[model samples]
Target: MLDLVAVLLALGLLMYLAYRGVTLLILAPAMALLAALLTGGLPILGAYTQIFMTNTGAFIVSFFPLFMLGAIFGKLMDDTGSAKSLAGSVSAWLGPERAIVSVVLCCAVLTYGGVSAFVVAFAIIPVAAALFRAADIPKRLMPGALALGAFTFTMSALPGSPAIQNAIPMPFLGTTAFAAPGLGIITGLVMLLLGLAWLNRRAARARAAGEGYGAHADGVPGPDVAMREHAQGEGFDIAELSGDPAPGKPHRDGNLPPVALAVLPVVVVIVTNFAFIRIVIPMLDTAWLAEPLFGATTIESVRGVWAVIVALFFAILLLIAGNWRRLADLRASLDKGADASVLPIFNTASLVGFGAVIAALPVFDLISETVLGVGGGNPLMSVAVSVSVLSAMTGSASGGMSIALDSLGPTFVDLAHATGVSLDAMHRVTAVASGALDALPHNGAVITLLTVCKITHREAYGDIFIVACAIPMLALAVLIVLTNLLGSF
Candidate 1:
């Protein structure tokens, strides 16, 4: 009982620290270590080893490079006005009356292609700025809709969302890729329709209400940083990235040849990912390979790290030219780009580590014992519902999942061993459950987007909460029912 209290206290402390804006990477692990000390784990040595190994592992960090790869592509798209061109091309097809729907579609597709919401936001916002401007829509309204487009279904309920926050739970749950694919696809399509419908209606309502209809229309959209509300700090020099503050000058009816600008980074990242999988992964399959390095890592982990480094290199080139103007201007631009990504990365990393500590220690184990005692007959439902409720309370998908997964992941593995369920299914349930609950008003990602986009928590969040919570909760119930019904077959 005391162990359970210690664990919950640790989780609560970490969550509170995150809320207070402490460095998550630093604080979360600290909370975990503190918890371990209270619980009397394998040893202080074991806890330290676990924290370092998990937090700093190459596989753990491969996503950082992936992010760099994605961010560079987004940054280029933002700067070159290419994203607007893409948005423009799509809007041209979808028609003005349906422009908002089109933007949502674009966001959904790009995000489903494995982009994070932050990357999607940076990439989409500028283009949305252009598309909305052309359609006479307000920029403030665009962020909410755009965030929904990228996040709502494709991220929360859909298949193959590359969100590590979502994907990491799969192995823990005992589900298969094939198990939930059909349901996930249907959910995405249904969600896409619902989102578009809601957004279109909102656009119409705003238009009819005539509140700030034409107010603060002071910007041109596209990669024109000179035209943006530049954030303070040493970030990128907008002048170099923006290439002259003049939104005019008819620079030409054309920019970089579309092929080079449009596809370079994407192609580069794909090649790197494939190359590492095929060429590098097999090379590490030997006994001697372990000793050649510092013995701290296997070639596999190093390969992952190297791949990220290469991706970032290509990314820097994709964003900046080799000329004097770009160099003189890069310091500020690079700094700014780094700034956009740094805090979020650090925050995510810290939270993940803290989550690891909580899990690796007995805190999670203590919770599981308690839940199992109370779960009674329908353990699966109990697990899902309890996780969902806790996540919603905290307004964090990953954080809540971390707490739940750490506690129950091993137990679920044991259950799968006994019941013949797949870990992948369990992972899916945990992930879906986390994102669903995270629809709460205070979830950092939701709150951040709302704050940055200048929307009230009141205006849009309630609708989002309904979508996040209702759809997935019901979906999970239906899945369980069908699973049982079909198991008879």
Candidate 2:
């Protein structure tokens, strides 16, 4: 009982502190030790070194390549003006009347193409701001628009998205990113359509209220606004326009590239990713993958991750090749990307480490039994509930999913096999489940999106919660029911 209290307390503290902006790198170990001391009869330092660091290191080793490449690809897209060109073209084609849909679609395209969600937020905000202002939509709706696009479908439910949320479940389930394609498409569309309808209704309400891009002191400054303020009417400087180039640097081409050239790299990532998973990997003789050095892993175990890596690598090369002249410093962009991946990977790894220590405790057995039993003989319900709760508690979709899977994944796998459920079903359901409750107000991604758009939670978080959290939860429920009825595809 005392052990349970300590563990619960530690979890609460971790969440509260994370919400308060404490670094998880420091918070995770401290909380783990606290829980360890309360449990008693354990080597505290050894737990930190052996359990925590080992798990953290293992996560980094497994995922570092994807993180690095994804970041580089996103950065290259941003620096080369491809992201803006994509956003601008989409916004233009959709026109101001369809501003909400346009912003969401642009974000979806960028994220589905492997751009970091963080990068997508920064890349699309200026465009989103301008479009909203032009359409007479409330500025407060910007975060929800961005969240609906970046956080919901593309981040989790999309078939070939390179987001870590989609990739994290692959090895555990021995499934590809294309897992449960039918279910993924169905759920993705559900969230997309429902979220759009909600946002449009909100827009209609605002219009009825006679509200039009209500002024905010910290609202994102659009390039058009900047151009209007400048006495010379010189148009936006490169940095001001795309928000990529650093000041005091020699300016490259400020003009948006041809739409085809701008969008091709993204297309490359998606197409190459699908091809690698469906065609190339199947043709390879992967018998050596069963060796101890490879952890006796099979092609399915690594195919999903490998597909994304190759896709991102090729896309990065294409981005560089096409935008070589426009990039002010290719090396700087790569270095920035490499540097960008460190915090997110480490943050998630810290949570994984924390989970490892917690799992080692005797008390964890009780918690696990309760969580595992919640499904009452249904693996889908068990996975969905456990992952959703952990994700909400952690305020990170990836971190929460990693922790839950690391601790309970094997048990879930056994449950699935015994119940005759497909691993692909398990994989897709878990991935989608993580995205649901993980959009709680304290979620790092949500907070970052709000901060980037310079909107207060009061003005925007309600809409975000509805679209990203509530709608996704509904989609998860439907998915669970569909899987139970139709069985996995």
Show how many residue pairs clash in every candidate, following the order shown: 24, 0
**lDDT by residue for model 1 over 359-379, one digit each (tens)?**
676556555565676645344
Candidate 2 Cα misplacement greater than 4 A, ranges: 217-245, 248-253
Q: Give the TM-score of candidate 2.
A: 0.93
Q: On residues 391-485, what C-alpha lDDT tens digit does candidate 2 reach at each position?
A: 89888888889988999999999999999999999988999999999988777777667766877789899999999999999999999999999
Q: In candidate 1, how many Å is residue 175 off?
A: 8.0
Instruction: Give the alpha-carbon lDDT of every model.
Output: 0.54, 0.85
lDDT of 2 at 228: 27
What is the Å distance of residue 149 in model 2 from its true position?
0.3
Among all candidates shown, the one with the greatest TM-score: 2
